[model samples]
Every structure is written in C-alpha cells, then in structure tokens.
Target: MDCQVIFQPSGRRGTVKKGSSLLEAARKLGVDIESPCGGTNCCGKCKVKIDEGYVDELSAETHISHVSQLTENEKNMLQPQEIRENYRLACCTQIEGDILVFVPEESRSTQQVVLETGKDRVLRVNPAVRNYFVEMIPASLEDHRDDSERLKAALLDRYSHLDKELSIDYTVLLSLPVIVRKGKWSVTATLWKEQVVVALEPGLVEATYGVAVDVGTTTVAAYLCDLTTGKVLQQDSMMNPQIRYGEDVLSRITYGMDDDNGLAILHQTIIEGINTLVTRLSKAAGINVEQVAEMVLVFNTAMHHIALNINPCYVGRSPFAPAVRKSLDIKARDLGIRIAAGGNIHCLPVEAGFVGPDNVAVLIAEEPHKQEKRRLLIDIGTNGEIDFGNKQRLLSTSCATGPALEGAQIKFGMRAAPGAIEKVRLDPVSLEPQYKVIGEADWFQPSQTIKAKGICGSGIIDIIAEMFKSGIIDPTGKFNMQQTSRRIRRDANNKPEYVLAWSEETSIGSDITVTQGDVREIQLAKAALYTGAKILMKKWGTDQVDSVTLAGAFGSYINKESALVIGLFPDCNLDNVVAVGNAAGDGAKIALLDKDKRVEAQEVADFVQFVETAVEPDFQPQFVQAMYFPHGKDTFPHVQHILDTIPTVKRSKLEAL
Candidate 1:
C-alpha cells in the first residue's frame, strides 16, 4: 500500500510505501530535513510533528494510528515534552497511511545565504568555445561538396585565420545539412578550441553562453556568462542535494561504499541540480538551454570524485589518492548535463588528497603564485583547504573540520539563515550579550520580540571569543562557575551552558544556548583548521605570513576580529586579513571566459605541493595548544590589546581537577 505524505511549511507532497520513514518521504518530495546522521536515527535532528487531525476524509482516530509508535531510541533521544506534542523522529517513524507532517524550522534545512559574488578581475575574452558566422555558396551538380567540407571552407574563407583541419561532432554533423539549408547555406558554427564544431545553428547566432559552477559540499552555485562579451548574465544557487546523503565528505564517501547505488544517486542528484541551474539561468537570461555552450566545474577531491561517479572511498582513506589528478574535458551530454548538443564540460585539475580543483580555482583567482609577499589562503568549510607560500613556492593541505563551524553537530546550531544569530558581543564586565540575527538590521533587544532560532558559524565564533574575553569561559573553553550572571546555567544533563536567548525571545520555545559540548565541537573544528595552517606554515619554514586571504562562502562571512580572536590561523596583521568571497567560483568563471586560465589552473594544481597533516608528528601538540582561545603559545600582536583585557586563568588551576 502507498501512503500519501505531505510536508508542511514547504507544502511539498508525495506518496511513499506504507512502511517508508518520514525522512525517506521527505527526501522523495524534495523537502530538506537535516539528516546529518544519514537517516540512521542517531542524530535525532530530523524531528517532524504529526498534525493531530484527520487526513482528507479519514477520521482523526484512524489517521493517528498511521504513524509507527516511537521506539526506545526515540524515547531516549527526544524530550518528554516533545513526545507529548506529537513530535517524532522522522527517521524513526514509519508511515502506515496518509499524514501531514510539519517540520520545525530547526529541523528543516533552511535556504542558506550562499556566497556567489567574488572580486572580479579583468581578463581577455578568449573562450575555448567560439562561434563563427559563415556564408557558403549553394551546392549544385558542379560544386557538390559535402556539408561538412563546404562549412569548413566557408569558415576559412570568411575568417582567413582558420584551422585547415576542422572536425564536426557526429551529432552536429547529422543536423548540419538541415541547419545550413534552413538558413540558405548561412549558418553559425560553434567550435571548441577553434578546431571542432560542437553546434550548428540556423542564421547568425552571435550569442555564446557558458556556465561556471562551484560545487561545494553544502551548496552549489552557477554563473551564466556571455562568452562573446565575457560578462556574467545571470547567477543562481541551491543547496547541494547530496547534502541529504551526508553532511560532510567522509560520510558521503561512506554512503557510496556502503550502498550499492549510492554513487549513482549522488552523481545523478548533482547533475540534475546543475541542469536545474541551467534551466533557471537560461530562462532568466531569455535564452534556450541549448545555447549554453560550455561548463567549468570545481570542487574538493571527494566532491570531484562523487560528481564524476567515481568511488570516493579511496579518497577518504589513508594516503588519500584521487583517481585522477589531471584536468578532464568530458562531453556535457556524457555527464548528463543539459547544454548545447555537443558542448564540453571542463573539470579543473585537482591536487592530492582532499585538495581538489576548487583550491586550484582559488589560487588562480587570487593569483597568489604571482605575488612577492608570502600568502596564506584558507577556504573554510566542512573541509578546510589551506594554502601557503607565494611566488617562490606554494604548499597546500586539507583539514577535516567537520560540520560544526557550519552550524552542524552543535546543539541549537543552524546554517546562516533568517533568525540565525550571526553576531554576538558580551560586555567585558557585565557579561551581558547582545546579538544580531541574519534578517534583522539591529542588535536583538529584550523589549522586542525577536524570534532568534539558533547560532550560526559566525555567531558561534563570536560568542566563543566573547565568552573567553569576558571571563564567562576560560582559555580552556570551560565555563566559569564563579560567574553570577543568570545566563550561565546548567543544562538538563548538568553540563554548563550560556544562554544566548531566553525562551521568551526564541521561536523554538526554548532557550538557545552555547552548551559545553557546543564549545568542544567548535574547539575541535577550529583546532583542525588552525593546525592545518600551522602545518603548512611549518613546512614552508615561515613563522609568519604577509597576508591571509579567506575564501569560500563561510570564510567570507566570518568576522576577521572574531576569527583572529579564535585563532583560526596564524596571526597576521589584522589589516592584512581579507575575505575574497567565493574565490573558487570566481576561478571557475575565469576558466569559462578564458581558455588560458584553464591551462593556468592545471599548472597551478601541478605546481603546488600537498602536505599530509595527518601524518605530521607535531600535529597533536599543535592541535591541543590551538584548542585554547587564540592559541596557547602563538601570539597575536595585532589583537594583543584585546587579549590583555582578558582575565587569564592559571594552567595549574585548570589542571588541578
């Protein structure tokens, strides 16, 4: 039997097997519910409320029996109050009949504020795909040259700087005769590398379009560009559909290795995502999807392998070797991409381990290799990719920062969305905190009914730094039980936590807090990132960097002061730290507009050295010291004034326990 299921708020509806779990049904209907545990029912984050009402024509009594009773795991995971309100774990409950489930804002995967804009640089418009308008003489009995030969001759005659040996795509060749005849032997031929015909269109079609995509672990962004003008016409983004499979790269790889069809599912999902972007972008730009000639994509190694349908298990394993390190040119149709019939998809080269082409794209866009000053480029995300050195030399490494910084793995944490607290500041003496949510223009006021939901990555960093500076938490990230503030209290587990928003101020009907565990999760995540930067700096034999360039979506939004206070990287001059929004996406756009940049991307990938931080003997000590606020040993001279204000806790006192 099939059960009709409707997910509220989004109003997405679908039907699933009678035994299907709500999480599975949510996935089927394209309704995103956070399943960080991959639907194993371990995270208990996928909670959905079953409306206490009858379905269409069914009795309330009958509809109530459709949902499976909560199991022992749910009983243990969910709070008693939640169970009484009909809140059940989406992963644990099975649908026996029609049901309307309302996913709470905290459980629903909200649309994130994706970083799509980057610092644009002027580049020569030399795209690999070029369109040429050629007028050929009508063929007769005396001059019966084949359509392919006649088209080539006409192109050479019209342009004069033509490749004598021009090859037409088989699919394009099949339609060549009709297209040329339809326009009375006048046609526009789209060529790849000026040597192969990828598309043949009737009349003179001068508009050549391309899409540049950045496939992040959590989000995917696409930029539609006018190849002829080298200008971006439209841009769109969506959460990476693969996120439902796993919140991070390693988990997604495990899914592929464990499930028989996981790889295909992931690959198809991303392809469909890209196609959706194409359709949307083209429609907005007033063009057909077929007019989009080329695509350039960049992502980390795990995403690179999965998007290519290759098993990503090995990429996640020891000695992390990718299946391919060279740039590849695949047919758009071959990859299930909807574009010009014979268009090509260019994948930038990747470095070793998890450092893939996205990092290469970052390097290309930032041009760190051409600078005289030493630079540190960090693309902060679930997996942090760090690059160090300058024109003389370059090194790179990847760190498993997990999803904590992106608002995963933390209690009361959420992505950067409306109602997400994005900024926090604690008064030095009073320790009273004022915060700003994403949608609000001003700091939250007690007088106003601000429905703050949760703290996001930036807010998490800010709160932790403010806590340390204000003496609410010590350098060791332990709550100071001595504080008399009412905000400092114990959770149900008797663990210490700092309440950011009181129950009356929140939409979740509970106090939003920074728990002791949340602090630990951030500490671990930040340590991984800081340690990776430290390892690269050590390998480069430099104790300091001239500049720090923060790339990617999360990195761009992070407050430089907060980042410095948290010691996300080796301390540099505060003025030198800058965020280049979505540099990887910019690199993809550069590659799409210029053929030379693609070659430069490969060169950059090949030139950089990959450092395996997991194997470093000093990794543990560095990580431990980094776990402290602003680092235990490293000095941030720029932020030293702020540090001096902090009431230092004695190491002996901390270790005495």
Candidate 2:
C-alpha cells in the first residue's frame, strides 16, 4: 500500500511506502526536517508530531537518560496532543497509518534565527587519565621482608605506595602478573580512576595530552583533551588574533585587501596565538608539544580561509563565494599551526557563501532542524548568520552586523573575559546600573575588585537600557539634555559620553566611557541584526515564529529586557528566546566526541541556503532606517507601543545592549 504525506509550511505533498518512517515520508514529500544522523536514531533529533492520525503510541520504551538534559519521564511520554505541542523524536517514530502531523517551528530547523541552549557538557572532565598497575614477585625466605619493604628493595628504592596501605581492584590484580611480566617486572600505568585504567605501558608512562580549538573571529577557545582516550583535559580561551586589523569580517576583508601579505599575516597571527596558547597549556599540563597529538580548528569561512592561506577576497564580493566549502583534514604545519608535524588538524566544513564552518559544526551538533517543524539556527556575532531548513529544503544567510555586538568598534568594547562587565541591571526607579563579571563562580560581587577594563557585550546592553530609562536617549537614538547625571559627560572628541567607569575605578588611567561614536557603532550593528532578521522572515514567508535561539557569549550575557528594548532582535516570544553559550565550541566538542559527526557537518553545509545581505537591495535601506535606538514600528510592529513611550531626541541615541 502507498501513503500520501502532506507538509504544511512547504505545502509540498508526496507519496511514500506504507510503512516508511514519518521522517522518510517528510523527506520524500520535499518537506524539511533537520537530521544530522541521516535518519539514524543516534542523534535523537528527527522529532515530529502527528496532529490527526489513527496510530498507536510507540511500544518500545526509549529511555532519555543517555540523552543530554532530558529525564526519563519526559522521554517516556510518546503521544503528542498538538503538532506544535507534541514531543516526537522523528528519527525514532514511524508512520504506521494515514495521519496529519504538525512539525514544531523550532524542530523544523530553519536557518533564519537560531538560539542554542547553554546547558552544554563541554566543561565536564573525561575519565581517560593514565594508570599504572605493578606487582612485585612475592618476597621469599631468602629475600625475607614485608611486602612493602621487599617491593621497595627490589624496585631500587623507588617511591612505592604499598607502605601507605594502598587498595587495588581485583581486576587490576587479575592481570597484574601478566602486565608486569610483559614489561619484565616493571609497568607504566595510565589511570583515569579506580573504575577504569585507560592505558598501560611496559614501563613508566605519562598521560599529558592534546587540545581542541575553535578559533573564532571575535574570540578563541582551546580545549586540552587526552589523545589516548579522547578526553578533554583543560580548556582556555582568548580573543582572535586579527582583531587589531578590524572588528568584523568586512573590516578584516578590507584589511586583507589593503595589504598584499594580509592573508598570510592574519594566518600567522592566528598560528602564533594558538602556539602561544599551546605553550601555556603544555606548561600547565607539565607536558611537551609532542604530547598533543591531535588538534581541531573550527571557525568561520573567512577564518578557515585565512588559516589555510586561501584568498578571501572572493568572499567579500558578489555571490558571496568562498574558497572551499568542503571539510579538510591536513597537517597543522600546512596551516602554519605550531605543533608536531604528525599532528592532525580538522577544519569544519561550510554550508553556503555566508554560512561558514561555524554553522556546519552547529547544525551537526544540535541537529535542530531534524524535525518536521521549521527550525532557525542563528549565530549572533560579528556576522549574524542564520540557517533554515526542515528535512528537505535548507536556507542560509549572513548579516554583516560588524563587531558592536561582540563589544568591538564601541568606545569600550571587549570580548567576554575577565575584568569585563557581563551583567547589568538598571533600577526602574533609580536608573542606577548594577553590573557583574564572569569568574570561576557566579556571585553578586567578584572575588577581587579589578578595575573595569572595558565594556563587553553584556555591558553594552546595560548601557543602552539605562540610557533609555534616564531619558538620556530618545527613541531615535538621540541624546536628551533634559535629564542629567554624573554618568553623562562630553569627551575630548567633542562627542557625548556615557561614563561607565570613573577615572580611578577602571584599569585604564582615564575614564572608560561609551561615546556617541560608540552609539553609532551599536546602531549599525543593531541595524544589521534587524535587517537580517527581517529579510529572513520576509523570505521564509512568516513573521510569527515558535522559537528563536540566541547563541554565543553576547546572547548569554545580555538581558532579555535590554535586548528587546534595544531592538537587537525582532519582537517574539521571550520564553522562546534561549541563551546557548559557546555554541560553536560545543559543536566542535560534539565532533570531537563523535567521529561520524564530521561527515554530518558536511551534510549540514550542503543543505543550508545563504541570502546575501550586502547584495540585496532592500538590505541597505533597512539598515539605514534601523540606525535609530529603537527601530521604526512599520518594520517591527511588535514593539510599537514601547517605541511610542520614548520621546524623539537625537544626541544620545542608539543604545545597544
């Protein structure tokens, strides 16, 4: 028997085998659903719900324990009431009878605007440390000594722990003799814990290991991982090396165009940065460079291009082309990375012209689009890239938002790091700003009072909200002189300044202020965001969305109120807006853990659609109009009432939180 499957959003219908899986039916019908596992159930991503159908619930009990974050009961419930409300794992569910299904908007996995959650397990430790199991021949009457004494005497007085009353697992004892005899009475052991010993050597061996890197344009992060067991050891992060050239891809592109050796220079800078980080990491781990056998490099298309010495000028121009969209595995030295010549460098693939390796890694990791519902994967950074797709069609695009969101270009913009203010709250009545910083733990006040170094993304949000509240900036992003406070001032540049940190309160000798130029920078940044989001919705043919994922450091730190007030994003469900921290890094970690995911990255790259924002005629005008602190209500009707409350002023405009 044949079955007819109908899709709502796509309005594309097709026929499939009677017993085919719902995912397969959707795919057959040209309906989009994100499936990183390629219809496999391993990822648990292909989720769809049946709205109208005569079908029984799944019988086999599928536990959600192994799955990340989900609980058993949440996993046990199989029937979905509303196609929008139902929870169905598409990869696992099958189509047994005629049915009408509703795919969740988030589960559809579109490329318009994606917000990944931050409950990542990348910080967890791996149980793959080295361990040694040694046993000395039982002391005879002739040797005549206690077990500890005899063992120490025979081992040339080495530091033996037998005297300390050590306990050993029987499993270790069971193979102790063979292991010792294999090494001629001496053995080196790599112990992860009492439950598992990952490695063993004929003699003494060390367990210091390798690291993974996601070298982003705005920020760089390194993960120290054990090579033998593929366990992450230590992780470190910093801003990218090319920031001095310019803030965003466009500026970097211009910088590259100006200098003949710009590409190579940018390449070498990143290499040196990574090498310096490697040296520091090795020193901390008490290991040499040789111990790091494998390293992964994940970044955007331009970053990958720069790293590989590819000319990125093409990416800056029409059609928004890239040098290479395919994933490649090569030697670290080939890319000028400092490491053993034998070390491997893995580069994540790219989806489209603007959607680069970062999106590829993210799609493969999150598998957000592996359902019948439409899904939007939005990566907010120097370039606000989006991916929209279901099981069949995928669209992708990039918004050239510049570096303001990441705190670059602003008078006091810095990456989210130590001494960078990350949290800010303005009292509705007082309009006083209270801020917090990121540290080992979350607390009201930081452990040590480091002077305010610079305003990071989170601080930018706070500044914007406070400016709006105090009436210092009107809806048009203009400054109002009616309200006065010590926080407001004028800088030498003859620009209006909002004093974020006092002269003595900051690390810099002078006061750290957010100037008018900074406001303009944020305006352009937010404009880019607005235009990109609007274009996608216009293209995708919908304004009302089920969910919007806010990823990266900026998304995590910025307050929801400030984000909405500044109009960084379109008006949507606040509950749907989630913060997924270090999504790119998390994607890299997923690839590291699962080797098969590398191929899935390529698939994700191939399926996404890229909308060229610069080339689009409407983009620039939308961008210009979006220059104000609050956008025009015509474009964003959702925030009309809020925009109406603020007066029209121009000096201290453009608040970006």
Candidate 3:
C-alpha cells in the first residue's frame, strides 16, 4: 500500500510503500536526512519525530497497527536516548500509514550555539574594503576620458597607493552613468583593497560589514561584523543542511564520491543555509544585504571541499590527501553565497589532511603560540583536534572520535537540549539516579518525568566517571554484574545493563538504561581523545599535561571532574583544565576583524607541526591503553580529591551469595 508522508517546517511531501523507512521516502522526495554510517542503522543521527498519523496506544490494536514495529536496532537505540516517546530512527523506522514527521534542530546537530558573548581581540581598523565619496567634474568633451577611466583617475588622485590594475564587476560599469549623474557627479565608490570597485552609491555609507563563518560538519555559525568599527553587529547560526547527507565529514566524503550529484547537493545545502543566515542577520541588524562586502570561513578540509563543491574523492582514501592546504581567496559569487555581488570570501590556511582551517581557526582563537606556559588545546566534536604548544612552537593532530560523545551512535545518547539529561549523580548507598536536564537549573530526581530524558555527551562522561569512582564500574569500564539491585538486569541479548530511569519516570514510556555496548562507545570516544593528547606529549618529551583547554560547545558543557576521572585526555592540574568556548568560530571572527590577526593565524598554522594519527607508529598502542579508565594507571591526583570527599562505596562485588 502507498502511504503518504509529510515533512514539516519545509512542508515537503511524498509517498512511499507501507514498510519503507522514512529515510528512504525522504531521499525519494529530495529531503535531507543525515545517515553518517550510510543508513546502516548504526549512527542514531537520523532521528525524526512523529507528529501525527501513528497510533501509539498499542492496546487492543485488533491485530493490526498503523506504525510498523521498531527494528531491533531502533528499539535498542531509543532506550538509552529516551527518544522512544515520539521519535524514531528514520533510517530503520518504516511507515505503515500516512504520517507527519517533525525533524528537530538537534536531530541534525547543526544548530550552532553562541558560545561567547564578547569579542576577544582588538584590531587596527584597516579593512580591505572602504567607501570613498568623490566629486567628479561633469565630463565635457574637453575631459574626454571614458566613465570608467574618469572614475579611476578621481580615485587614484584621492588615494595614491591604489592598485594600478583596478578591476570591478561589469554591472558596476553598466550602472556607473546613472549613479554618477544621480549624485550630480558626486558619488560614493566602494573599493576593495584599493584595487577593484565593488559597489557604487549616491552618498556616503556609514559602515561596511563582513561575515565570519564556521562551517562545521553539522552546524554553521555566522557573525555579522562591522568592518569599519570592528564591532560585532549580530550573529546567527543553524544546522548545516548538509547534515541530511551525513553527520560526519567522512560520511559526507562518501556521499559525494558515491553519487555524481552528491557534491552539488552538499555544496548547495551549506550555501542555502548561509544565505538564509545572511538575510536573517542583515534584517535583524537593520542593514542592507548588500552592505556585507567580505566573508571569512574556517572549515575542516572535508567541509571545505564540500562547501566549495570540490570533489572529495581522495580525502578519505589512502594517503589522505587534501585538495589544497594553502589559504584561498574565493569570490562569494563563485561559491553562490548571498552577499555583496563582488564581495570576496577568504579562507584561512589548513593544516595537513582533514585538519583544515577549522583547526587553524581554533589556534588563532586560542593563540597558544603567544603563551609561555605549556598548554593543550582540545576541540572535540564528532572529531577531535588538538594543539599543544607554548611560545616556542605549536604541535597539532586530528583524531576521529566519531559522533558517540555528541549523542549520535549512542543508544540513549542525545544532544543537550530541553529535555536531554546533561548532568548526573549516582547515590553510593542507594545507587539511585539524580540528574538534571537542559533548560533546567536545579537538580531533579530521575523519579521525575523531566529529569529522565536521554543522556548527552557531558552526562555520559559524568555517569561513567562517577561509576569508576564509586566502584560500580571497574577501571576497564565493566559493570559488576553480581549487583543484587533490581535496576541492574540482563537484557534479551544476555548483556548487563543499568537502569537510569523507569518507564513512568521518563518522557519515553520505556526504561532508559545504559547497556554494556553503551559503555564501550564512551570508552572508544575518550580513548581517541586521550591517545591523541598523549601522542603529542610523547613527541614533546613531557610526561606532564601542563594545561588543557577544551573547545567547542560539547567540550564546554562537559564536566571537568568527569573528564579527568575518565582520562578524556592526559592528566593536567584540575584547575588548569578550562573550557574555551567555540575557539574555531572565534578564530574565524578574529581573522575577519583584524588584518594582522589573519597574518598571525596563517603563520601559526604554517609553523605548527601537524601529526597524523593514522600514520603515527605508536598511536595504536596508546589508543589501546587509553581505553581503560583514567588511562589505566595515569593517576588523577586531582580526581583523588573527589574520591576522598564523595561517599564512594567499596568494590566487593556483592559477596557472591
């Protein structure tokens, strides 16, 4: 039977066979839904909420059903994330009847958070584009120069250091006569780098604006900045629509290589999202869309390729080559971004491999090369980028941590949103759960409905780290299966699981539990991060992790105690571990605002030694050792304070009856 399906917000419509997955229908209708594992039903990134047309009350269905049964994968995936209430894994969920699907902003994980409120640096205010109002002699036959040559003379006379090879959009030549005459030969000219004229107006303009963009795998953040005053007028962000193709960069690369039009679709998705933001930010800031005269972007190499519509076929293959690693100046028009017609988009330099300008951007934001004390900068998202250095030199590396810690690929994992659990504490004596959700400040008992949503990256770290300290889980992240509590039980697969919340207590009508599989996901993610940092330490010939600065939204929200207890990275003084919010985005802004800062960013990116984890000889062994809690023996002198103060129970395994 053909069943009708509708996607909301976009108001897209389609039809599919009764048993077809929503992802399949979405693909048929050209709707974007991310499946990073290529729809293997492994990554839980393809989540969609059922808005209507499904019967949830399974009571006495008369031996029939409207919604198809959840696949074993979907059933196992939703419990830990508590998404079973109304959401389904779109890749695995089949439509049995007409239904409306509501895709949340978090499902794509592209919604950018305004991680910082204030600007970080001061600039010299020498911008590339400047508006000059010059009065020209109304041309007579005596002053026989053409309109273009006449304007060029007037501009050069006013500014002697102008480029001799000036160029401009043909439209500027097409409209120059009317503009010059309309202002009585006294017109305003917008010059870029004193080279090409980009815009012409009848009078003086107050400000020239620019945009600094962070094109992440799933999210994009844009800052509308005042180029003249170096003031941030406003900022905007949204899920990178490319998330419909994949939640991770490699998946996106596969999408592009697998389909001829995949590259175009990926390019169009991000361009549309950026254009939408440009319009929104301009209107909100009370500025004309054409006022934005320049843009700067920082992306991981894969995102950089996809954003520019370059074929990413070689990025994921052997040798791991990138299209280009140098800084580029691409015209916004060529990239199809909506801004001033002749505006330019400057991309900062990229390091080797997938560690592109986004990594460089974080370094620009952190300015590690300017510091004297040894420090470690970790920007962990679906992937992890590390920068370690002081004033002498900077060392960096990239690691594929996957999306587990970001809430995808985890059974009960979810983004930090309204009902998503962001904090957790397990009682030592009772082993009952106390947790907090996003959008709520106070801690609430998991016995309450709102407190029992699926866990987020930070909460996952907290629970596992706390379990290690409380003797519930061992250094290897194994559960003491002998526990007598009713909360611990064996699932149908005969694997041990711990219940975080009962069915009635959660938004979902089923218990939210962490399985043995869930623990492994955490182990894998944390190990990647720790190993990367340790490799740098090993290369740097230092056993000490002087300081650690966590970057990005997920890193900022993570509990430092939990991160330390789990050895998310090499050991550092607890107080030295700090969160630097959205360093990559901030780096883009720094380049956008300061010309000198852009040069510095390039120098730092170029000078820093980039270590590729894939080819590193000792990386595999470090990764294996890192899988154990607190790095299997790397003492957490800082974590000992919590272990001593907190009422941790003994590890006696319930006395074996």
Candidate 4:
C-alpha cells in the first residue's frame, strides 16, 4: 500500500511505502537527521514528531530515550508518556500508515560529511566568486580611446546604475589589453565582489579554481576546488614531504635549529609537494597549472612554521609558545607557494604550539562544547591532544600518546591503508577466527579476499580485547604464552604473536600477527587516552559527562567495546560515545565556505586553555596504572558489563583468568 509522508511548519510533503522506517524514508529523500550512533536507535539526535499520523508506539524495550527537550507541540506529535511525550527518535520509529512528520532543525543533518575519493564532488557550483560577460559598444569615429580607457569608460558608463567602482590588480592588468583586443573589444573578467579584478580572459567563463591542503606531519591531503562554484574538483593525498628530516615536530625543529638552510629545505619540500598535487589535480580536472587562483592551507604550528620557513626553536621550549597563533592571509609568492599569477594562500588559525590549527579546525567543525553537558573531543595522532568542555567553558591539553595508535612503533603495525587488517571476530563454533580488512571486502566471505598485511588502529583495539579475553594478557599487561592457544604462536625473536591470518592465506610472506611489542605500544596509547580523560574529569569537578565525541580519521571506525577492553577511555556509559568523522576536515570545509567561521575558529583557538601533559604531577602514575588491561569490574562497571556478555572462551589455554 502507498503511504503519504507530510512534513510540518509549512506542511511540505512526500511519500513512502507502507511499513517503512521513518528514518530510512527520510534518508532516501535526502533529509538530514543526526544519528551519531549510526542509526542504532540511540544518540537521540534524530528526534522527530509525528504531526498527524497513524503509527504504533515504540515498545518499552527500545534502547532510545523517549523523552526530549522539544516544545509542547513537538512533544504532542510524538508517542507521549505521562511527564513527556510526542518526541520519537527517527531511527526508532516506523511509518505503518499515512503520516505528517516535523523534523527539527537540530535533528536535521547540516553540512554532512560527504564521502570523498579521487572523483567524489563535495560542493555545489554556485561559487562565492564568479565570472561575468560585459559587452561594450566600441568607440565610433565620434569617440576614440585605448583599451584600458575604453574598459573604464564602459564600466563607468554602462554599470553606472550601481556603485560601479573597479580595482584591477597590477598582475592581471599585464594581460588585460591583449585579452580585450583578442575578444574584439569585449571581455570576461573574473571580478571578486564586482570590484577587484582577479582575472581577465578573451571570453566569458563559468568558474575559477583553488586548492585546499591539509599539511600534517605524516600526511598531506590536497583538494582541488572550483572557486567560482565551490565544488571539489579533485583530491589527492601523499606522505608529507618533510618526513625526510624527521617524524615529529621536535625532531624537525631540531633539524631547523641545527642547520641554517633547514627551514628553506622544509619550506621547499612542502611547497613542491603541494605544487605537485595542484598540478596533478588540475590536470585531472582538465585545467591549466597557471589558472589556479588560490591555495588554502591548514596545519599544525610546526608544519605551518616550516611551510613558511619561520623559526620554530622557541615553540619547543618552556611555556610552549607559538610565533603567531592567528590566521594569516598572504601572497602565494611571498611564502613561495609557486602558484599562478594571482593566487593567494590562507592558513587557518592556530591554538597553541602543541594544540595547533588542526585542533582549531576540529573544534570549528564539530562544536562539541556547545552542549551544556560535558563532551570531550579527542584527536589522537603523533602527539595525543584533547579538548574538553561544555557550553560555558572549554579546556584543551596535549598528551604524548606517541604514534602507537597510528600503527607506529609496534612490531606488526601499519596504517589504515589497503590490505591493513581492520577488525577481528572469533568463530563461535570452532573458536577460530574471522577478520575484516579496510578495502573492498570482508574476510569471512569466500568470494571476497584480502591478504592481511598488518594490523591498523581498529584491529589493534580488537586484538587487545581478544588478548584480555584469552587470559594471555594479565591485568598488569604481562603476556603469558602458556595460557594462550596453540594458534597463538611465539617467535624465536622472543615476541608473542597472536596469529590473525595464516601464512598461506595472507598477503604478507608469513602469518599476520600482533606481536608483544605491538601490545605494549597499544597499552601506552591507551594509557595516554585514559589518563587524559581522568585529568579532564578532575578539572571539570565531575565524572558524569553528557557525551564523548571522538574526532579524526581513525575515530569513526573504532569499536567502543574493544576500546574499553583496551582501557583506552574512562568507564563511561557506552551510550555516551559519539563518533564525529573527520572533524578537522569538516572544519576545513566550513572555513572554506564561511568567512565568519574563520573568526569563530580564531575565538575557539584563543579561548582553549592548554594543559601541558608533560608537567602534570599525576600524569606518570595514571599512565602506569592505565597501561594494565582493566581488571576491577566494579571500578569500570560500564566496561565490565559489556565484557560480561561476550561468548565464553572454549579452549583451556585461551580462557580468561
């Protein structure tokens, strides 16, 4: 049977099939609803009210909270209870018949994170900058003039209906005469705000071009964008060119400090990398290298300093200062950005030396602190950094979580690139294994195949959980080979290996294993994460947080239960976890589109209270204790309850203590 879906406020209308989930139908129609729990009937972010509808009320067994802070009219439309009603989570409700639904603005998804790859486009074509065609009635025998004078006369004569003031950059004026003469006294000028002449060509055009680059210590991602239309033209990513000198900022700073030419090389390497990406992406978009108009960069403090060849020695010392923590706009050639004639480059604002532009970008994108209840935004990478606050106050700190979680320092570690093992699941009947890789397909399906290379961040979480369950890792984090299964092999190199994929089936030459060193690295990573959480809870004067938001590349793919088993976060309610994918990238997108967001980013950066983790007194003890696999179930009640429900270990050697 056909069912009609009606929306409220203005009664905008749509249709759905009978017995369809309301959220599913809304999603099919390109409606936005915030379901941070991946539509698991949780998060309560997708709440909508049924204005006029015949629908069954949800059972008490539904996991989502029925009550909401919506208005009386909104509540009346939801399946109401005694104290509160009418608010139904979109994911939890099914449309059994005809219905009129009203989606709140907060519930509706805004500026979604569109999945991006080489070809995926992210924005519409109506750009902030546009090209216009202006036809001029050329000088007759009665009037005579040069091209510039004619152009100026035409602007003052024809566009005089408006406040027709024009300013041409000396750079574009070099080609203006030839362009005007070639177009037969008529031309298309790329004018920004109908004033500044950024470009001039022989004919009318549709769009302009720009590049957005995220400069990380390890990776650099570039997105070619159409400035006239604000669409992502092409994207390419590569390892940061500065890695030849060092992996961390301190090392790179030392490199620059020791050598006079170090800053120049660092600056040149990044520019060359960005220029290469711009050239490649521009070619893919069928555009010229010199036609690109602007390049925007977002990076950490040291990366920013190195990109501009600024001295970074003071950034590594006491008080941990930065040369400039505010956003800067400069000429591309001034910073050696090697772009086209009129290209300009903009850098996002920085927070502090340790907490830099990346963190500011994340905050600008997610706005987690907008909640009245406490929420923590953790961006874990080379240096573990976290932002904790609520609607009223905000605080930030950096932890030396190392690069452990990024699959560094561990014996069998790798990034989340193709062939990286990403998830692990035990076979219920055989007590054997099933796993998943990042790209293409799953390990369980016979037709789908992936040769396991090494474990990534998510896989590390699962492996840590499995070790705890197998009794191979004690609460103190000591590996006991005698207690583990025969499948769990030990190497002659004195490393304990948990065989995830065997040699015959794997892409690597030998069995893909998580080694003893890998386990230690994960433990250290977890220690940093948990210790930071503990410290923040102390500063806030309460442990009861409204929610925890994980932000970054790896945050979206992590398993909360596995994370808890590894002691990566404090024992909070599992329902409180929210994964905001690529918050930094989202922030970059916002900064790209909204000029006001740049100001907001600067405000957030200026206000974020930075806590230096290296100096905290309790940091070392908390780090040591948190390194252990959590054992006191009472102390971690929320985590323990989740672990209690998993299938029991079968093999004697693999059983937990």
Question: Candidate 1 overall Cα lDDT vs. reference?
Answer: 0.88
**Model 2, stretches more than 4 Å misplaced?**
1-118, 121-210, 227-230, 251-260, 282-288, 336-340, 417-419, 427-432, 436-448, 484-495, 501-504, 507-511, 634-657
- What is the RMSD of candidate 4? 22.6
lDDT of 3 by residue, 209-315 (tens): 89889988767888898987887888888877776677788877877887778899888888898899899999999988887888999999888888888888788
Look at candidate 4 and give me any clashing residue pairs: 32-109, 75-86, 78-86, 80-85, 125-229, 127-228, 127-229
TM-score per candidate, in order? 0.95, 0.63, 0.88, 0.72
Clashes of 1: 0
Sorted on lDDT, best first, the list reads 1, 3, 4, 2
Per-residue lDDT, model 3, residue 242, is 78
Tens-digit per-residue lDDT, 412-476, candidate 2: 56656565666666554454566665542442343456556666777787788667755767666
Clashing pairs in 1: none
lDDT of each: 0.88, 0.62, 0.77, 0.66
lDDT tens digits, residues 240-284, model 4?
A: 666545556776787677667877777887888888888889889
Clashes per model (N, Cα, C within 3 A): 0, 54, 4, 7
- List candidate 3 segments past 4 Å from native: 1-12, 16-21, 27-38, 44-89, 92-119, 445-452, 643-657
Error of 2 at 532 (Å): 0.8
TM-score of candidate 4 relative to the true fold:
0.72
